[model samples]
Target: MPRVTFIEPNGTEHPVEIANGYSVMEGALNNSIRGIDGDCGGNCACGTCHVYVAAEWRERTGRQSEMEHDMLEFAEGVREDSRLCCQIEMSDTLDGLVVHIADSQH
Candidate 1:
Protein backbone atom coordinates (compact mmCIF):
# COMPACT_ATOMS: atom_id res chain seq x y z
CA MET A 1 0.00 0.00 0.00
CA PRO A 2 0.97 3.59 -0.62
CA ARG A 3 0.11 6.60 1.50
CA VAL A 4 -1.55 9.62 -0.11
CA THR A 5 -2.43 12.92 1.47
CA PHE A 6 -5.44 14.79 0.21
CA ILE A 7 -5.47 18.43 1.21
CA GLU A 8 -8.85 20.10 1.37
CA PRO A 9 -9.52 23.60 0.08
CA ASN A 10 -9.45 24.89 3.67
CA GLY A 11 -5.93 23.43 4.15
CA THR A 12 -6.94 20.38 6.15
CA GLU A 13 -5.00 17.22 5.31
CA HIS A 14 -6.41 13.70 5.24
CA PRO A 15 -3.70 11.11 4.84
CA VAL A 16 -4.52 7.47 4.23
CA GLU A 17 -2.96 4.33 2.88
CA ILE A 18 -4.32 3.16 -0.45
CA ALA A 19 -3.93 -0.19 -2.14
CA ASN A 20 -1.20 -0.30 -4.76
CA GLY A 21 -3.55 -0.78 -7.67
CA TYR A 22 -6.32 1.65 -6.64
CA SER A 23 -6.75 5.11 -8.01
CA VAL A 24 -6.40 8.20 -5.85
CA MET A 25 -10.05 9.09 -6.33
CA GLU A 26 -11.05 5.67 -5.08
CA GLY A 27 -8.88 6.06 -2.02
CA ALA A 28 -10.36 9.45 -1.22
CA LEU A 29 -13.93 8.20 -1.60
CA ASN A 30 -13.27 5.03 0.36
CA ASN A 31 -11.67 6.96 3.21
CA SER A 32 -14.45 9.57 3.33
CA ILE A 33 -12.11 12.38 2.45
CA ARG A 34 -14.03 15.56 1.69
CA GLY A 35 -13.66 17.76 -1.44
CA ILE A 36 -13.37 15.01 -4.02
CA ASP A 37 -16.69 14.26 -5.67
CA GLY A 38 -15.95 11.25 -7.86
CA ASP A 39 -19.32 11.61 -9.51
CA CYS A 40 -18.41 9.54 -12.54
CA GLY A 41 -17.14 6.70 -10.38
CA GLY A 42 -13.56 7.12 -11.58
CA ASN A 43 -14.57 6.84 -15.20
CA CYS A 44 -12.83 10.09 -16.14
CA ALA A 45 -16.12 11.27 -17.68
CA CYS A 46 -16.65 13.91 -14.99
CA GLY A 47 -14.14 16.53 -13.96
CA THR A 48 -15.39 16.73 -10.39
CA CYS A 49 -12.36 14.89 -9.07
CA HIS A 50 -9.95 17.66 -10.02
CA VAL A 51 -6.92 18.11 -7.76
CA TYR A 52 -3.50 19.73 -7.78
CA VAL A 53 -0.50 17.48 -7.43
CA ALA A 54 2.21 18.83 -5.24
CA ALA A 55 5.28 19.99 -7.20
CA GLU A 56 7.56 17.43 -5.65
CA TRP A 57 5.33 14.57 -6.66
CA ARG A 58 4.30 15.76 -10.09
CA GLU A 59 7.01 13.92 -11.96
CA ARG A 60 6.19 10.67 -10.19
CA THR A 61 2.52 11.05 -11.14
CA GLY A 62 3.41 11.61 -14.79
CA ARG A 63 1.66 13.71 -17.42
CA GLN A 64 -2.09 13.81 -17.88
CA SER A 65 -3.62 12.06 -20.84
CA GLU A 66 -5.33 13.98 -23.63
CA MET A 67 -8.75 12.92 -22.36
CA GLU A 68 -7.84 14.09 -18.88
CA HIS A 69 -6.57 17.39 -20.26
CA ASP A 70 -9.85 17.96 -22.09
CA MET A 71 -11.91 17.30 -18.98
CA LEU A 72 -9.73 19.59 -16.91
CA GLU A 73 -10.58 22.47 -19.23
CA PHE A 74 -13.96 22.60 -17.53
CA ALA A 75 -12.44 22.73 -14.04
CA GLU A 76 -11.89 25.92 -12.08
CA GLY A 77 -8.45 27.08 -10.90
CA VAL A 78 -6.69 24.98 -13.48
CA ARG A 79 -2.91 25.05 -13.20
CA GLU A 80 0.22 23.26 -14.35
CA ASP A 81 -0.20 20.77 -11.55
CA SER A 82 -3.94 20.29 -11.93
CA ARG A 83 -4.94 16.69 -12.64
CA LEU A 84 -8.03 14.54 -12.47
CA CYS A 85 -7.21 12.37 -9.46
CA CYS A 86 -9.08 9.44 -11.00
CA GLN A 87 -6.16 9.12 -13.38
CA ILE A 88 -3.56 8.89 -10.62
CA GLU A 89 -3.17 5.24 -9.75
CA MET A 90 -1.38 4.33 -6.56
CA SER A 91 1.93 2.44 -6.66
CA ASP A 92 4.77 1.58 -4.32
CA THR A 93 6.94 4.35 -5.79
CA LEU A 94 4.25 6.91 -4.95
CA ASP A 95 4.14 6.20 -1.26
CA GLY A 96 3.85 9.81 -0.18
CA LEU A 97 1.79 11.40 -2.92
CA VAL A 98 0.08 14.65 -1.97
CA VAL A 99 -2.77 16.31 -3.82
CA HIS A 100 -4.65 19.50 -3.14
CA ILE A 101 -8.38 19.54 -3.78
CA ALA A 102 -9.46 22.35 -6.04
CA ASP A 103 -11.46 25.09 -4.41
CA SER A 104 -14.25 24.55 -6.92
CA GLN A 105 -14.55 20.92 -5.89
CA HIS A 106 -15.69 21.93 -2.40
Candidate 2:
Protein backbone atom coordinates (compact mmCIF):
# COMPACT_ATOMS: atom_id res chain seq x y z
CA MET A 1 0.00 0.00 0.00
CA PRO A 2 1.03 3.53 -0.59
CA ARG A 3 0.74 5.93 2.31
CA VAL A 4 -0.86 9.15 1.12
CA THR A 5 -1.01 12.32 3.12
CA PHE A 6 -3.45 15.18 2.48
CA ILE A 7 -2.76 18.48 4.17
CA GLU A 8 -5.54 20.95 4.81
CA PRO A 9 -5.15 24.69 4.41
CA ASN A 10 -5.01 25.09 8.17
CA GLY A 11 -2.34 22.37 8.52
CA THR A 12 -4.65 19.51 9.45
CA GLU A 13 -3.60 16.20 7.92
CA HIS A 14 -5.41 13.14 6.64
CA PRO A 15 -3.44 10.04 5.85
CA VAL A 16 -4.54 6.83 4.22
CA GLU A 17 -2.99 3.61 2.98
CA ILE A 18 -4.17 2.81 -0.48
CA ALA A 19 -3.37 -0.10 -2.75
CA ASN A 20 -0.87 0.43 -5.51
CA GLY A 21 -2.02 0.98 -9.10
CA TYR A 22 -4.76 3.48 -8.26
CA SER A 23 -4.29 7.15 -8.93
CA VAL A 24 -3.87 9.58 -6.05
CA MET A 25 -7.19 11.18 -6.95
CA GLU A 26 -8.98 7.88 -6.57
CA GLY A 27 -7.45 7.32 -3.19
CA ALA A 28 -8.62 10.71 -1.96
CA LEU A 29 -12.12 10.45 -3.41
CA ASN A 30 -12.67 6.90 -2.21
CA ASN A 31 -11.36 7.62 1.26
CA SER A 32 -13.34 10.87 1.52
CA ILE A 33 -10.10 12.69 2.21
CA ARG A 34 -12.01 16.01 2.26
CA GLY A 35 -9.92 17.98 -0.20
CA ILE A 36 -9.77 16.50 -3.66
CA ASP A 37 -13.11 16.62 -5.48
CA GLY A 38 -12.04 14.56 -8.52
CA ASP A 39 -15.09 15.93 -10.33
CA CYS A 40 -14.15 14.11 -13.51
CA GLY A 41 -13.05 11.03 -11.64
CA GLY A 42 -9.55 10.02 -12.68
CA ASN A 43 -9.73 11.70 -16.04
CA CYS A 44 -7.49 14.63 -16.83
CA ALA A 45 -10.34 16.64 -18.30
CA CYS A 46 -11.27 18.30 -15.02
CA GLY A 47 -8.99 20.44 -12.94
CA THR A 48 -10.91 19.78 -9.73
CA CYS A 49 -8.42 17.23 -8.51
CA HIS A 50 -5.67 19.79 -8.55
CA VAL A 51 -3.09 19.50 -5.81
CA TYR A 52 0.39 20.65 -4.97
CA VAL A 53 3.08 18.01 -4.92
CA ALA A 54 5.56 18.58 -2.13
CA ALA A 55 8.51 20.49 -3.56
CA GLU A 56 10.90 17.61 -2.87
CA TRP A 57 8.54 15.08 -4.43
CA ARG A 58 8.21 16.96 -7.70
CA GLU A 59 10.99 15.08 -9.50
CA ARG A 60 9.88 11.74 -8.15
CA THR A 61 6.36 12.26 -9.45
CA GLY A 62 7.55 12.99 -12.95
CA ARG A 63 5.96 15.27 -15.52
CA GLN A 64 2.25 15.77 -16.15
CA SER A 65 0.59 14.84 -19.42
CA GLU A 66 0.12 17.53 -22.00
CA MET A 67 -3.64 17.59 -21.50
CA GLU A 68 -3.23 17.69 -17.74
CA HIS A 69 -0.80 20.52 -18.12
CA ASP A 70 -3.24 22.51 -20.19
CA MET A 71 -6.11 21.81 -17.81
CA LEU A 72 -4.02 22.86 -14.85
CA GLU A 73 -3.58 26.22 -16.50
CA PHE A 74 -7.26 26.70 -15.64
CA ALA A 75 -6.95 25.46 -12.11
CA GLU A 76 -7.43 27.93 -9.27
CA GLY A 77 -4.62 28.62 -6.86
CA VAL A 78 -2.07 26.98 -9.07
CA ARG A 79 1.57 27.16 -8.15
CA GLU A 80 4.79 25.97 -9.73
CA ASP A 81 4.35 22.64 -7.93
CA SER A 82 0.68 22.25 -8.84
CA ARG A 83 -0.38 18.94 -10.39
CA LEU A 84 -3.58 17.06 -11.02
CA CYS A 85 -3.90 14.25 -8.50
CA CYS A 86 -5.33 11.96 -11.19
CA GLN A 87 -2.03 12.04 -13.06
CA ILE A 88 -0.15 10.58 -10.13
CA GLU A 89 0.22 6.82 -10.39
CA MET A 90 0.25 5.10 -7.03
CA SER A 91 3.36 3.11 -6.16
CA ASP A 92 5.54 2.12 -3.26
CA THR A 93 7.86 4.92 -4.24
CA LEU A 94 5.01 7.32 -3.53
CA ASP A 95 4.28 5.83 -0.11
CA GLY A 96 5.01 9.04 1.68
CA LEU A 97 3.48 11.36 -0.86
CA VAL A 98 2.32 14.70 0.48
CA VAL A 99 -0.29 16.78 -1.33
CA HIS A 100 -2.44 19.81 -0.64
CA ILE A 101 -5.92 20.17 -2.08
CA ALA A 102 -6.75 22.96 -4.48
CA ASP A 103 -8.48 25.93 -2.94
CA SER A 104 -11.34 25.59 -5.38
CA GLN A 105 -12.01 22.00 -4.42
CA HIS A 106 -11.81 22.67 -0.72
Candidate 3:
Protein backbone atom coordinates (compact mmCIF):
# COMPACT_ATOMS: atom_id res chain seq x y z
CA MET A 1 0.00 0.00 0.00
CA PRO A 2 1.03 3.58 -0.63
CA ARG A 3 0.21 6.68 1.36
CA VAL A 4 -1.40 9.71 -0.24
CA THR A 5 -2.04 13.10 1.29
CA PHE A 6 -4.83 15.27 -0.06
CA ILE A 7 -4.62 18.91 0.94
CA GLU A 8 -7.70 21.06 0.99
CA PRO A 9 -7.92 24.68 -0.05
CA ASN A 10 -8.07 25.66 3.62
CA GLY A 11 -4.78 23.85 4.34
CA THR A 12 -6.27 20.75 5.93
CA GLU A 13 -4.55 17.51 5.06
CA HIS A 14 -6.21 14.11 4.75
CA PRO A 15 -3.78 11.28 4.48
CA VAL A 16 -4.63 7.66 3.89
CA GLU A 17 -3.15 4.34 2.96
CA ILE A 18 -4.27 3.14 -0.44
CA ALA A 19 -3.91 -0.26 -2.00
CA ASN A 20 -1.79 -0.73 -5.06
CA GLY A 21 -3.59 -0.58 -8.41
CA TYR A 22 -6.30 1.76 -7.07
CA SER A 23 -6.77 5.22 -8.48
CA VAL A 24 -6.01 8.38 -6.47
CA MET A 25 -9.69 9.29 -6.72
CA GLU A 26 -10.51 5.96 -5.09
CA GLY A 27 -8.14 6.70 -2.25
CA ALA A 28 -9.76 10.06 -1.58
CA LEU A 29 -13.32 8.79 -1.84
CA ASN A 30 -12.66 5.71 0.29
CA ASN A 31 -11.08 7.82 3.00
CA SER A 32 -13.93 10.31 2.93
CA ILE A 33 -11.57 13.08 1.88
CA ARG A 34 -13.45 16.14 0.74
CA GLY A 35 -13.20 18.01 -2.58
CA ILE A 36 -12.80 15.13 -5.00
CA ASP A 37 -16.20 14.45 -6.52
CA GLY A 38 -15.11 11.53 -8.71
CA ASP A 39 -18.45 11.84 -10.43
CA CYS A 40 -17.46 9.62 -13.30
CA GLY A 41 -16.39 6.77 -11.04
CA GLY A 42 -12.70 6.87 -11.93
CA ASN A 43 -13.37 6.56 -15.63
CA CYS A 44 -11.74 9.89 -16.59
CA ALA A 45 -15.02 11.05 -18.17
CA CYS A 46 -15.48 13.84 -15.63
CA GLY A 47 -13.08 16.56 -14.57
CA THR A 48 -14.51 16.84 -11.09
CA CYS A 49 -11.61 14.93 -9.62
CA HIS A 50 -9.05 17.55 -10.55
CA VAL A 51 -6.01 17.91 -8.30
CA TYR A 52 -2.61 19.57 -8.32
CA VAL A 53 0.26 17.19 -7.83
CA ALA A 54 2.97 18.51 -5.56
CA ALA A 55 6.07 19.50 -7.47
CA GLU A 56 8.18 16.79 -5.82
CA TRP A 57 5.74 14.04 -6.78
CA ARG A 58 4.77 15.24 -10.22
CA GLU A 59 7.31 13.10 -12.03
CA ARG A 60 6.25 10.02 -10.17
CA THR A 61 2.59 10.60 -10.99
CA GLY A 62 3.46 10.80 -14.67
CA ARG A 63 1.94 12.82 -17.49
CA GLN A 64 -1.70 12.94 -18.45
CA SER A 65 -3.08 11.25 -21.54
CA GLU A 66 -4.47 13.15 -24.50
CA MET A 67 -8.06 12.54 -23.47
CA GLU A 68 -7.34 13.51 -19.89
CA HIS A 69 -5.63 16.70 -21.01
CA ASP A 70 -8.68 17.57 -23.08
CA MET A 71 -10.99 16.96 -20.14
CA LEU A 72 -8.85 19.07 -17.80
CA GLU A 73 -9.45 22.04 -20.06
CA PHE A 74 -12.82 22.27 -18.39
CA ALA A 75 -11.46 22.08 -14.86
CA GLU A 76 -11.06 25.19 -12.77
CA GLY A 77 -7.61 26.50 -11.80
CA VAL A 78 -5.84 24.47 -14.42
CA ARG A 79 -2.05 24.44 -13.98
CA GLU A 80 1.10 22.62 -14.98
CA ASP A 81 0.57 20.09 -12.21
CA SER A 82 -3.17 19.76 -12.57
CA ARG A 83 -4.33 16.21 -13.18
CA LEU A 84 -7.47 14.13 -13.03
CA CYS A 85 -7.24 11.96 -9.91
CA CYS A 86 -9.15 9.19 -11.69
CA GLN A 87 -6.26 8.88 -14.10
CA ILE A 88 -3.58 8.49 -11.41
CA GLU A 89 -3.22 4.87 -10.41
CA MET A 90 -1.46 4.13 -7.15
CA SER A 91 1.78 2.18 -6.99
CA ASP A 92 4.55 1.40 -4.52
CA THR A 93 6.84 4.00 -6.00
CA LEU A 94 4.29 6.71 -5.38
CA ASP A 95 4.35 6.44 -1.62
CA GLY A 96 3.92 9.73 0.19
CA LEU A 97 2.29 11.30 -2.84
CA VAL A 98 0.83 14.70 -1.99
CA VAL A 99 -1.82 16.46 -4.04
CA HIS A 100 -3.83 19.61 -3.56
CA ILE A 101 -7.54 19.35 -4.25
CA ALA A 102 -8.64 22.10 -6.58
CA ASP A 103 -10.75 24.86 -5.06
CA SER A 104 -13.39 24.31 -7.72
CA GLN A 105 -13.83 20.71 -6.60
CA HIS A 106 -15.14 21.95 -3.31
- lDDT for 15 (candidate 3): 86
Tens digits of lDDT, candidate 2, 1-106: 7899998887789998878999988998889987788888787988988898878998888888799889998888888889999999899998899998767776
Clashes found in each candidate (C-alpha, N, C closer than 3 A): 0, 0, 0
Could you arrange the candidates by lDDT from highest to lowest?
1, 3, 2
Residue range with the least summed lDDT across 10 consecutive positions in model 1: 53-62
- C-alpha displacement of 91 in model 1, angstroms? 0.3
> lDDT of all predictions, in order shown?
0.92, 0.87, 0.92
Provide the lDDT at 34 for model 1.
Answer: 84
Instruction: Score every model by TM-score.
Output: 0.97, 0.94, 0.97
1-106: candidate 1 lDDT, tens digit per residue? 7999999988898999999989999999999988888999998898989999988898899899999999998889999999999999999999988899999989
How would you encode candidate 3's per-residue C-alpha lDDT over 44-96 as one tens digit per residue? 89898999997888888989999999999988899999999999999999999
